[model samples]
Structure formats: structure tokens, C-alpha cells
Target chain A: MHDRRSFLKLGAGAAVGGIAAALPSAVSATECASNIKWDETRDVIVVGSGFAGLSSALNAKRQGLGSILVLEKMQVIGGNSAINGGWLAIPKNPIQLAQGINDDSPEELVKDQIISGRGMQNTDMLRQIANRALDAYQLCIDTGVKFREGFNQQVGGHNKARAIRTLHGVGGDITTKLYEAGKKEGVEYRLQHYVEDFIMDGQEIVGLKVRQNYRFPDLKTGKTIYIKANKAVILAHGGFSRNLVLRELVDPALDKTLDCTNALGATGEVTLTAMAHGAFPVHMSFIQTGHWGSPDEGGFGWSNALLSIGFHKGISVNVLDGKRFMNERADRKTCSDAIMKNRHPDGSPAYPVVFFNHDDHIGAEEVTRAVRDQIAWKVDSLEQLAKQFNIPLAPLKQTVAEYNKQVPQRIDPLFGRMMDTAVELKPPFIVSRIWPKVHYCMGGLKTDLGARVLHSQTLAPMKNLYAVGEATGGTHGGTRLSSTACLECLTMGIIVAETIKSDMQA
Target chain B: MMKTLLLTLVVATLFTGAANAGDLVKMKGSTQGRSNHEFIYQDGCKGCHQGSGKQNATDAACVECHGEITSIPVDESKLAIPEAHPHKSLHYNQGASCLACHGEHEKKAPVCAECHRTWFKEM
Candidate 1:
């Protein structure tokens, strides 16, 4: 292994050599007005190549920034944006031009966002995001992003079904289009680079130090590169959804179960780096946890699978000494919390088994088949199924019998099972074991309405440091609505670009 | 002096034998126990081996010689698929690597399809 000092020496040497090699023969007259290192000085430096980073780079170029640099830590350009369900929820988007969807106004949008945010939302921040959503959506459309039409519906708190999705299917498609657009606009995309930390001159962020992946066979040794920016550095690196330490630091309760769909690089390292440089992280405790999958299985939890299989409409009985505990039809989070409470006497990890009868199985089968063709469903007598699942047969039988007896009334006195699904007590019973898992982190580096990173307590904007996408938090107040994460990314990307442009011009 | 020389030869032989055995095992494992001729299929093995008529190719030789495997068109029709689902397209084109999702690795093939297929029920 190379010594740290030796590595630094090599990196410094390589950086100097690389600069000497790539530096323009003479400083071009059109270069930004700065005497900083030629390799370091760019009018705008975007610190990710996801939806937000790419958007910022393209918009910055459009805004006449002399030199634009997009640094991607991954080996490729698109970040998590390339791996997500490509849904962009813009309430009252102009793409509604072709479709007769309900038109939304900025005030209504603010109202909806505030309601979804549930008093945790910064109203001013939300208002800013709402006001510019249409223009951003239109901009995306103009840049070859085809918004899917006709499938608009309420996700979480929105009063109307105005969320627009990409025809490219999911996040990756939207990101690819944006990346292509950025490339067309001459955005210098550097991949396989990890941003170590922000270069700080006291409180102000001046530049960033990055390390390129030298592990490739072609490259002899990895090198550290410094990027100094004349105008601004936008952090579109995404949220800390996969960082356990950061998750535990922010919310201790989340330490128990926080399973996210974010990438491995989503370690919240960028957030910590920002905080180390005096950036405040807000809404740390606000986490999104609705879907519950099998703890043993590594994917979206079983509760979501069960919901997909119509289990939400079935009777859910929490068996404690052969007795029902909570109402079965309680909200998903509430149900998950109850299951967590009943894990074991010593508070071991809880695994709640969902029981359903033949009718419930049919409903579940319909839902599951619609989502995915591969789902293992078993049909057996209630007692036999209970025996197969290792649950006590007598108690489970009694629980199902009672649940079925109550089902005729069409109202569950125990768990408030609504939606009028049949009682799961008869032959051909099915059960799925599930537990709660951590999903997403709603807290990140504190930012202003313009997506500018701010000092924690003072609320002062960090100089030339902007944050968009999941890297910055302040948009989703306490809880993130279902599809708003993708929406937040695209809207904030456009917002940050426009803000940077205006700031530069001023 | 004779004992020391013999011991040195023994140690050196053991080390070299172990390394050669490991290499052979790895090569066999990669081809799923099939011989080089059967595993490589067609003349795919020749570009790396070059002048030699040997079927087996070294990792270094493969990287140095046939590094541009995608450029050697197996089929042009495969590339003409319409861009509908980027996630699916990434899976189809990149295979299984980080680039299938994150997008920048040039050499590593993206493996979104293999992993996501195993875990993601929606996929």
C-alpha cells in the first residue's frame, strides 16, 4: 500500500502535470475574470451529473458562463436520477396543453405542498419551488423530454392529479435525456471522480478537491484534482439515504430499520462535508417510511408487495395469545408501528405474518399479477396454512374465525378494515411475513429558496455554494409525499440554474 | 550448500506451481469447465492470442488486444432499438455494472438487469 504522504506527493505531481498538459496555450480572452489556477477556475462548477447537476450545467452554459464543469463521482454521468421511477410531479404543468388535466396555480401548488409537508415546510421555499415548476417542466419538454400523459393521479397530499412523468419510463430516462442535452451544450462532464471535500476559505466555499478512480488498468496511479470556480459550485450529489451513520445521527429511531433505494455512494458524506464547512442540516428526523418489505429479502419490503397483492383490503390480525391486537385496516405506517411494538418481549426484530383467505387471495393475486408475474402464492386450509407458516394453528384459526364473523357486517371493529374485501378465513389461505425498513432521508444540507447552501444557525448563504436535488433539504417539510422526490429533483435543478444565472448576471 | 539450493528450488517450485494452478482454475472457472476452443466460440479467441494458434488467452492480453469488444459488431440490428425505457435499455445494452444506473464507467458493463431482476419486483 502506498503511504499517505507518498500518495499526496504523487497526486500533486500528477495534478501539476495534468494541468500543464491541458492548460490552454494562452489564457483565452473569453475566460472568466479570475486569476485562479487555469484547471481550477471555471465560471460554474456543477458537482454531480444527475438530473439537477446536468440541468444546472446546461442552464449555466445558456446563461453565458465562460467555462462549465460537471464533476460526477461515479464512473458515469447520471446519478440516482438514472435509477429511479421517472415520475416528475408538476402540479399544473404546461404539458397539460394536450391533456385536459386540472390547471394548477402557484398559490394552489403552495397550499398542496404545505399540506403535504405538514407544517414542517418552509412556506417561502415551497412558494418559490411552486412558482417555477411550470417553466421547469416546459424546459424539460423543450429539451426532448416527453412527459407521459393520461396517467395523472393524487400521490400523497396533492388535491389534483397533476404530476407529470417522463415518457422515458423512470428517473434514468429523464437523466439520460438531460445528460445528452448537457453534452450537446458543451458541458465538460468528468466521470470516475469523487469529491473529497469543499475547499473553504474560512466560511466561504472556494472550490473542491476531488480524487479520480485510478483503479483502472490503464491508469497507473489515482490522482487528486482541485477544481476552483469563479462563480458558483452546485451540490446536486443527492441525499444520504444509504448512509447509516448519518441516518443514526439524524434520527435514532431510523437506526432500527432504514432501507433505502438510493445508491451505495448515497453515504451522506457530501452532507457531512457541507456541515463540516458550516452548512446546517435541517429536518433530520423527517424520514419517509411507508412500504415494509421482508427484512430477510433485499428489496422493497413485503408490505408494499402485499398492498400490490390486495392485502391492504384484507383483514390483518395481530395475534397475541390468540387474540387480535390492533385494527387491521389502519394506515400502513400505523400498522408497521404496531408490528414493531409486538416483535418480541426483548424488542427483537418484528416479523408480522399477513393472513388472507381464498377471496383475499384472489384480490391479492389480481393486484400482484398486475405488478409482477412472479409471486409465490399457496392455497391450503386455514389450519394447514397456519401449520405451514409455523404460526399456532388454534390461535390463528380463532383469529381468522373471529375476523370472518365480523366481515359480514362490512365493518371491522378491530383494525377498521375498509374497501369491502372478503374475510380471509376459508380454505386456500396465504400469508406473507413482513417488517418495516428505512426508506429515505428527508433531512440534508440546509438551503434557501434559490437552492443556495446556508450557514446552519445564521441562515447566511455559503458563497458560491449551491445545493439542489436530494443533497439539500428544506422543500419536503416533515414527510415526503410518494412521488414528490423525483419532482423535487427536476424542479430544484431548474430553480438552481436560473438562480445561478441571475446571481452571476447581477 | 546443496541442501539450501534444493530447499530454495522446492519453495520456488511450490510457489510457481500454486500460482499456475490458481490461474488454470480461474480460467477453467470462467469458461464453466469447458475447454478454451469450446468456451470462446468462433474466432473470438484469436484477436487476443494473435500469431499463436493457442486457444487460451491471458487477462492482460485480452485487455490489451480485444479491449474494444463492443466495436467489433456482432450485430448492428441490436443497436437500433428505439429509446423507450432507459432503465430497460440500460439493462439490455450495458448488461450488469454500475453504469446501468449511474452511467459513467466506460469499461465496466452495467448489470442493472441481473441484480434488479433478482430483487426489484416492479422490474
Candidate 2:
């Protein structure tokens, strides 16, 4: 731990500038005028131990800067990234190209993002993601984020088939590896430390006031410690999904009805700390929901594999009339939005019941696995499934007949989805009714191509401050595609790391 | 929020230990609110913690009294909606230190409320 007073005195002694010594005694120390002394000092302080934070720390350490600290508020290291479904949506990547699905480029990826956001996403940020998509993916591989072989799976909302998941199929694998990579590069970590506010030196952010040895949610109970950052403070602490009041301020629909899919520590205060320091925020209202959890599960359960199974191998129907509704093949946001827009015949929000009859199109292994995992609700027949879901029996039977007929012909005139000729009926239906859960926040603090947090009004880089991953917005505007959240983390991680390296050295 | 706010008030007053248990030892409040948290708190916190001026209750402490733990559903097994893991998510099973849903300082998280549909309801 380095004393800010002593450090200031040292700086004053070393530099010709007299203000370094004068400001401590005469003027305020931070934006909030915090009088707390410094507890520790580092070249850079990375918030949140998830992929983005760890990536930044690793990059900073690789640049040969000693004294890099990764502070995580959570008891565990990873934030939502640990619990996230481990799929990186990279455009024009070698995996997709080698898998013979490379018609889509960075341009297409950006276009999809813009279209998904309803054209609200920043073009420059999206273009950067598109152009350097592969570079980011490779960086993750270099950091030991191992993707399973032959597992370049395509997820929803993406126009082309381009995504690779971790071998464990969870963000834990990626986050753990990133943490290890940081450790390998001699990056230090301070877990269970909550950042209370940003320390400002003149107009530039120079340090942070943190709550050391902090309990998870009880905010008022921790030791106040200040840490100075010599070069910069990267706000990679993630988004505000967990903060209900803050979330509702932007999207009023995010009232208690919507459950945040992020970790508990993802409250907006970290971003608010930046905001308090004049770092402008953008798209705080444009939140994104995953829209694929069971009305039975309280939050996002372990169901990424199950969701893929449901979307790819099953047909989704509205519980209202037992009829096929929205294009189930659409991206997660599109499916979730359609569900949110519809009402049940009884005035309840229409629940999407995804049913897969043992048409044998889906392998027995997956069916058995889903059943064993208890994610798949298996019933004796379609009648039982309809009864379980409270859907009309006759209409559901008719809808399945129509869908099965169309599946063989490889044409869905209603939705234009190409269901290949692999689905063949056998017996015994397995089903699960799912709805949307508030998954990700598409809008956040605005940033530029260099991954620096920019002023909301002027859009200029906030000096000595940067944000990456879900903390900074613009990569996603109105919405984000499936498997893209992790991709954004990696892409922004590399960009910010390199930028910080060059800028600090320069 | 009203329920969680009230519950948070209860939790802040529930534990009378030290402010924080330092950087390494993860801290959790004693269970005293609605749902099964009261009983869980007794079993996990009461036996060993016993007002020891500490704040470290864990899943390991949970399994000590309850035997092998897999799920933490608010409702019965038959009544709860279905999921791949439901209450027994791998993140929790694989030793996620504290339950994101189980907050001693607050009501069980809203993730549980999303399906149960009575998140802030006073029970």
C-alpha cells in the first residue's frame, strides 16, 4: 500500500510542477472530494475478475508494467461471465469458414447487430468488433480459453453460423483461464473489494475509493480503502442488470417481473461512480433479455444446452390457441420480444412451450441427456404435453402435423425457416415451457473504437479512463445476438489491452 | 423491493458480528427471513458460527447438517417449473461460494421470484 500523501509529496519532489503538493493541502482529492488516503497503488486497476477485467490485467502485465491489480467485489472471481453460456459469436472467423459457413463477414455481423438494435448501435464500435473479431478470438485461445473441437455452433440472432463455445460450455472455463493467465503474468487480485467511487486528479481519474473486505450486498459495512492508479482505471465491472431501481429507470418494464440474469454485484454503482466523475453513459435504457427460461425456474438455470435443443430440435407454440407463433428460429431477442408482445387468451403473457416429439430427428442421447438433466419435460404423448402446458389439444396436434409436414419439405412458408429433412416421427413427446428473463443490458456507458469510455454528450475519450466488456456500450445498441456477449468481452479485451499498452508507454 | 428492503433491514440487524471478515474469507449474513432461509441459517450459521463474530457461512457448512445438497428450490419439487438444473445448477454444485439467490441480507433473489411470481410479496 502506498500513501497518496507520500506519493504526492514524492511527485512534487521529482516534478517541477508545484501543484502536485499544493492540491492535497489546498484543493479536493477526487470528484467527490474524498479525504481518504491511498491504501495501495498500481500502474492500472482493473475492476471485476471476469474475462474483460482479467484480459486487461493480463495485457497490462504483458506490457511489463509491475503492480497491476484486479479487484472483484464478488466472493468468487467471475461475474456474470462465470455463469454465462460460453459461446463467442465472432464474424469471419476461421472456425466458421473451415466449417463451410463463411458467407457472413464483419460487415454482416455489424449489420446484424445494428438490425438487432433497430439501428441504435454505434457504427464505429460495431465495425471494430467486426474487423477484429478473429483477432479477439485468437487472443482468447492464446490465453488458454480452449474451445471444443468441431464445436463451431451457430446460435440465434446471428445471420450466419459462427460461434465457438468453451469445452465446459460455461463462462467459468473462460474466466478461470483468464484469471490464470493474469496470474501467470503476475497480475494481483483483491477479491471481496467493492469500488465505492473514482478518485479524480484534476479532470483525469487517478485512483478509486474501495471497500476492502466487503460483504456481498450489505454495502455500508466495509473498510474504506483508496488505491491509486498511475496510468489508468479500466471500468470492466460489468453492467447494471442487478440494480432494479437503476434498471427500471431506463426500462420501466424491468420492474420486479423481470429477473436479472447477471451476478448480484452487477449493480450500476460502478458505472454510476464513473458517471459521478463525468463519464457520460449511453443506452442505459436499452436492456436485453435472454427470453428462454422456464416459468418454473426462478432465474436463468443451467439450460444453454437445453435452450439450443429446444430452439433447434423442437417447435415452440403459444399456450393460448395451441398454435405455432413467432419464428422460433429467430434470435433470442426476437423470440423473447415476440413473447413479451403477445397476450394469452386469458390475458396472461403467452408462454412458449417448446415440444419435441420423438420424431427421432433429435438423437436419443440428447433426449436422454435432457431428461436426465431434468431440463426436458418428457411426457407420454402430445396430449400429455398439451395438458402439462395447458395448451389446447386439438390445435396443438394439428400444428404439429403441419410443422412435421413442412419439416420434410424443407420449407416453412409462414416463417421461411429451412427445417432440414432429418425430423422423423417416432413417439413420446418431450416439452418445456419457457419465457424471457432479463439477460443482458445492450446499452451502457458509451465508448469508441479504441475501447475508451467517452463522454456521453461530446463523445470524446474520458482521459485516463477506459471501459470494456458489458460495462461500456456501443458494441450492442438496442439488442445483441446470441453467443455475442462473450465475443464482445474478448474483442474489447484485446482492443483495450493494446490501446492501454501503447497509450501508457507513449 | 418492499419485501427485500424490509428483509435487508432485518438482515442488517440480524447479524451482530464484525463489520467484515477480511479479503479472503467470504461473508454471509445469518438466515432469519422468509422461505427456508431461516432454517438454513440455523443449520449453517447457528451450530458453528453461534455469534462467533465471524461472517463466513458456506455451502460446505450447508452439507454438514443437511447431508449432500443438490437443490435449493423455494417450493416443492413437483410444483416448481422445470429447468436443466432447476435449484441444483452446476454453478452452485461446482462450489460457487455463495448462492446468488440466497441473500441473508436480503430476500431470496428475484431470480427465484421470476418463476414463483411473488418476489416481493410478504409471506
Candidate 3:
């Protein structure tokens, strides 16, 4: 890795030359700051257009920070945030209070986050997320994000029913509004501007070497130019869950053939660039594979909607044993790990199926589409379901009978899953195979409470360099809970803007 | 030597400008309505991409020929399932970029499949 000291020496050499050197024949991200002529200058350059980046730019511009610019590497804005299920987990919020879930607090929320993250959380950052959770939800509202009323559910790993879905149940509803709000606040967004590296002045980040109008997955498409950041550069470019090389680098156990739910642009280049500049990477090996992903269809497909419904209304059973495995409503890591353990002797995932009754009102439209796509099987009876998946019919019937007995008492004798309003599953079942997709990277560049990127060598804050959202680590340590990434991103966006404003005044 | 150098530069520039177009031409019968070559031949690289600047295909370019997506009526009879109306969506009806899902050079599945199994064929 290129150190700050070597870049400082290059800066010194460029200063001696006096004239800006022409860009070298070979495209390189690491260039001496002194030898570069900035194509444009912004007071603050937010390197992403997701919830974190746009929120930072919008909040910073609202705070009267001048000349803020948001850069998106893809042709589109929002990155993976555009396609996410817009479920923001906030504790003791008005939504929860209205629903009679009055037993949640910021302390409780942080405790749950730490529990899900396997106790390796940066407690301070988790507290920041917990404290600002309501504020983050309000930010979404103020920015014109319409939350669906009466759609709040207790997602896996959260202690309470604090997760609220957006109006359309997709995150684009949030991002499109955030983008529009940021634009209205005079925050300029330059899409297709791929930030390659930080242009450093000694140890401090001064500017970025960006490729403008860059085509995705194409290395030498856009014209490389350096843009000076007069105040700060906020790195909110998200994690590398889709990048197979980086995924294999940290966790080789993750199958190379596994599908991902991330936007095609969710790669490791930007995070890797920050690491090259001495930003410390944390929790790199703690990648989280989503338990809801369906093996039958590509990406985060229709089966996801059904599997979530199946958690509460149905049962998830291993096809081999024809019996329920782990709790369907367990934490994401626990569920994914449980599914992974039920592998064939050849080391392939058993690809267990989650099934709910066909008449269940939970996510009907989603199930219809999944069945149409042939990813979900809608069989008439338990015998047909067992026969279709080639499972033992007797064992399947016995498992369902056992689950039915527990449903009446609202108790699970086997795995201790919540059985609220769950009835005995009947005929005409909707069954879909469950396979783990490289969903979210639980690890990224480590940041302090102030959202400043920390340097690996000195363990000090990298001056004028900040990070937020999934791009920064330690908020959710080993594993992330459902709906919290949105909360963390929105919260960090607010916190980073305040921190940047304070730094500017100082 | 100078003539040869100048020729190489011109060829390299042209090659870089339509590098992705080469990938499009190879996928002859893969597209739904028209063959990949027909779109390239009739419209040219600049038709979809809009310029030689190596930028992505603009939504405006797509809409110019395809018309406004949201306004197009889906015949419910032809669809295999209900709610298969690909054009009219809950979010960003006309505002979403066409290139977000429909890739000419690189074949991309309908991004709706990313979340829902809305098995709408690629336009």
C-alpha cells in the first residue's frame, strides 16, 4: 500500500517542478497534489449519492455550507440505497407508541445492535445511531419520504416492533426524495463521477482524483481529473458485498457462485482506495449473507417478500430432513449460518425452503409474481409439497403438526420463535427455496464518533476526511440487524454534517 | 513514421468511443423487439449513448424512440401474472433512468427482478 509519507515526498517533488505536470500515459489514481490542476472546486465533496451522501450534502448546504458537491460513480444515483427495502428501525418513536409498543428506549436499541453485532460494536457510534434514530426518521419525513402507516413489524434481531417501512416499501422512495431535497438546497450532484483516490497534501486529504462521466465496469472510459475539496471529502460510497474478489479475500467460505442483492456498482474500489490512503478497515471478515435471498431467482427476488411473511405466518424447513431448522425469525447472521450448516456432503447449500399457506394475506402480490416466475411452488397439500421437493412426507406432516400445536399457545417448543397471530398452516402452501446472498458487508473503514475516517498507522482521525453509512465500520460490528442500515445511514448523514460544520468554524 | 502514429491515434480514439457498441452488435437476436444490430445500424452508437464522450445511454434517448414509459398501457391479458405492468411503477414512474435496468451493450435483467419477481421481459 502507498503510504502518506511517500505521497508527501511526491508532493515535494511536484512542488519543485513549479509547473503542473501533464497526466501520465498510464492511468494511475495516486498522483501528487502539487502536479495536478483541479477541474472543479467544492467546499464539501460527498463521494456518493446514497442516503448518507445526499443527506450530508443536503444537511451541510442547509447549514449554509457553500458549494457542496455530491459525486456518484454510477450513471444512477442512490447506489444500493435505491433498491433497498425502506425499513428504518427507530426505538420509542411515535409510530411504535401509536402501536402500543411503549417498552423501547435508546439504551435498549443500542443493546440489541451490540447483541446482533456480536459485542464487537463501537458502543459510541451505536449510541449515536440509537440517540439520533428518531431524528433520522424525521429527516426522512422532512425530506418528503412517506412512511407506510400501520406497516410496522418487528424485524429479525430487533427487540421491538420499531422498523417502519416506506410508502412503496422500497428505498427509492427515500433516495429519490433525498436527491430532490439536496438539489433544492442547491447541492450539485455529478453522477458518473467515479472518485478513484484521495489527493493528499502530506497527511491530510485535500482533494480527489475523479473520473468524470465514467461508465460502470469500464476501467478507461471517463477522463480523469482532480477536483479540490476546499473543506472536506465525505466518503459515503458503500460496501463491497457484490465484489466476489474482495468477498473471497476476507471470507473464502462464501461461494463464488452465490448471487448478490447489491446494485451492480456495489464494488470495493472506493473502500480499497481509502485503505490505500491509510484508513483502517474493521470487521472485514464479518460479511453478512442474507437469509431471505431465494436461490430460484436472481438477485434479491420475489421469494424475499414471501420468506419474510413465512417467518411469522409459516415455517422454514430443511428439505433433507423435512423438519424446521433454526428459528425463522432469528437474527440475520444466525439464520444465514444455520442455513449454511445444513449443506450437502459435497459442500453445496441444502437450499432449504420456507413455506406459508397460500391463503395467507401476507405479501400476496409478491407470492403471485414469485409463483409466476416459477421460483415459488404453490402446492395443494403438505403431501404434494413434500413430494415436489422430494422430502419425506411423514416427517413433513409431523413437523407441521408440532408447529401447529405451538401456534395456538403462542409458543415455540423447538426454536423459541415469536408466534404472534400465527395460525396452524393449512393446505395450498407457497414454498420457496432459501439461499444466502452476499447481502451487506458488515465491515468497512473505521470512523470515530465525529464521523472522521481514522488512519490505520497512527490511529488518529484522517484530517478533513469523513465517512458515513455502510462505508464506515463499527456501527454494526460482526453482523447488522434488519432495517438498521437505513437508520445508521440517515443518522450518520445528520451527525457528519454537524461535525463538518463544527470543524469549518474551528 | 508520423503518418503511421497519427493513423494509430485516430483508430485508438474511434475504438475507445464505441468500445461498448462492439459488445452490443454481437448480441444479434437477444433483445425483445429488435435485434441488437438493427438498433445499432438504424440509430448508430450516438443514438442511444448520445455522444462520443463515452457516457451511459441517456433516458431521454431511450424515451425518444420508446415514448414515455409510464403512459404505455400494459395489456393485462398478455401478462402471466397480475401486477406485471413493468412501465408504471410505484416509485419514480417516469423519473427513473431507462439505462438503470435496460443495458444495450451489457445485457442486464429488469432491475424489478432485483426485489420482486416481476418477470417483465427486457425492453
**Best-fitting candidate, scored by TM-score:** 3
User: How well does candidate 3 score on lDDT at residue A430?
Assistant: 86
lDDT (10s digit) by residue, model 3, range A260-301:
888777785678778877899999888878778887776566
Candidate 3 lDDT over residue span B42-108, tens digit each? 5545755656525555566656555677665567786654544556554334335566567755557
Tens-digit per-residue lDDT, B12-108, candidate 1: 6466654421122233324321122223334454544445534222233433422322332233343223342333353122211233232110222
- In terms of TM-score, how similar is model 1 to the real structure? 0.74
What TM-score, over all chains together, does every model reach?
0.74, 0.69, 0.77
Q: Which candidate is the best by DockQ?
A: 3
In candidate 2, residue A325 scores what lDDT? Answer: 78
DockQ of candidate 1, scored on C-alphas against the true complex (2 decimals): 0.07
DockQ each: 0.07, 0.11, 0.23
Interface RMSD values for all candidates: 7.1, 6.4, 3.4
- Can you write out model 2's per-residue Cα lDDT over A255-347, one digit (the tens) per residue? 555555676667756786677656778788888777676655544664444666667667778887888777777776677777676575565
Question: What are the runs in model 2 whose C-alpha is more than 4 Å off?
Answer: A1-34, A89-119, A153-162, A297-338, A341-352, A359-366, A386-427, A456-459, B1-123
**CAPRI tier of model 3:** acceptable
Task: Using lDDT, rank the candidates from best to worst.
Answer: 3, 2, 1
lDDT of 2 at A486: 77
As a TM-score, model 3 comes out at 0.77
Q: Which stretches of candidate 1 lie over 4 Å from their true place?
A: A1-3, A6-41, A75-77, A94-103, A214-223, A296-309, A317-325, A342-350, A355-376, A417-431, B1-123
